[model samples]
Target: MRTRIITAIVALAIFVPFVIKGGIPLTILISLLGVIAVGELLFMKKRLLVSFEALVSFVAVVVTILPNSFWRLLPAPAFLNPRTLIYLFIFLLLLTTVLSNNKLSFDDAGALSLGVLYIGFGFHFFLQARAENWMAFVFGLIIVWLTDSFAYIIGRKLGKHKLIPKISPNKTWEGSIGGTAVATIVAIIFAESTHFATHFSLFEIVLATLVLSIAGQFGDLIESALKRYFGVKDSGTLLPGHGGILDRFDSMLIVMPIIVLIGLTA
Candidate 1:
């Protein structure tokens, strides 16, 4: 617990500044995070961090994470569209299977490909949210954090039925519902307190908040499912007592994408 608290404090110290200064610096920060998140999935899959998949997937993620403006600023030769680069890298991943005489296997390449999309788009949407609306960004983070926090607190006290004991044994329906309920309320309060104006109507914002809160829980469960399948405890060891980048940002990974998909960006 102590380690977890300290890690959160330190992480925020770095995170808040980049968030406030959203530009190339923030882009660089998120790109680095996307790289690490991809690395964690590679490690979980029993792939070497220095392997071909790692190199290819890292590049794929960075390509996906780079905003449209940044991509335009690159040198002429580096002007390949993001999709073009992604497709090229993906082909390379499959090529590795044949090159290695099937040692890497088709399934391995597929997994890495999926990881690229999962981590890549997740961070890309995060960057988009920050770039699009500051309030929208904060709202998404609050949904994930408050939902997790309240779920733990209320679940311990009032939990009865397990939400999904097989994947995350600690989660309960009581906690899940209670968490979403509280998060929704808090999000509305935040919206009101900050006079969080957006193109969307207040009704739309409230509805979106509810959706994001629910999505955040699903995101948590998705990561838990991944860990269960990998037979590992944490995603990585980067954060003390907090697991890894994925562990810390798993909920956000899901929320960020939904924030854009559902037009939560103010």
Candidate 2:
């Protein structure tokens, strides 16, 4: 517990400044995070499968940063939504091919692809969010962090009934509610402070906050399920006292894309 608190403080000390600055520094931080996430996925899988999976994940990350027109390089009759088509193509391509007869077989490849899309493809959402409005992009991050922190602290203190015993035993309904409430409050504060007052009503802030917070919790649950199914604890030991890159940012990965989409539409 002490280690976790200390690590959180140390990470914030390093991260807060760049977040406030929000430019190339933040972009570099995002790129480094992408690299670390790729490393974590490779680390989680079998050694033999690591290379290929990492390569594919890397390509996904690259595609995320690249322009949408670049995807037109692929053979035609593409869907108006190139992103969806691209993901579907990747999924089908992997499902059809036989990688190896090993334990981490075709099924594992599918799982890894899911991770890639979750982490890699989702990052494009972050990029899009930032491109639209840097403030909105940062707000999404703040909302996810607030939600996770509230959930952890509240669950640890007052939790009785398990939310998902098979995945994350510590989570509870009380914690989930507390997290959502706190996130909603923070979102409202952010909207007002950032001059979203003219553009969005209190109801809109509340709605966006609700969506992001729920999505963020679902993201955490998803990662927990993945770990439970795989019989592993912590995605990797890359970060001392924090498990790994994925362990720390699982919810953020999922929420960022959704928030980005909302920002784009809004």
Candidate 1 segments exceeding 4 Å error: 75-79, 195-198
Separately for all candidates shown, the number of backbone clashes (residues 3 or more apart, or on different chains) is 0, 0
Which pairs of residues clash in candidate 2, taking residues 3 or more apart in a chain or in different chains? none
Per-prediction TM-score to the true structure, in the order listed = 0.95, 0.80
Local accuracy by lDDT, each model: 0.90, 0.72
lDDT per residue as tens, model 2, 1-266? 78878888898899778766755676667667776776666666654434655565666655554434345655756563447644864664374455443444566667666666677666656655665677777788888988988988898888887887878888999899888898889877887888643566777778878988999899889878877776789887866788987888788777877776565225
Worst 10 residues of 2 by lDDT: 95-104
List the lowest-lDDT window of 10 residues for candidate 1: 192-201
What TM-score does prediction 1 earn? 0.95
Error of 1 at 42 (Å): 1.0
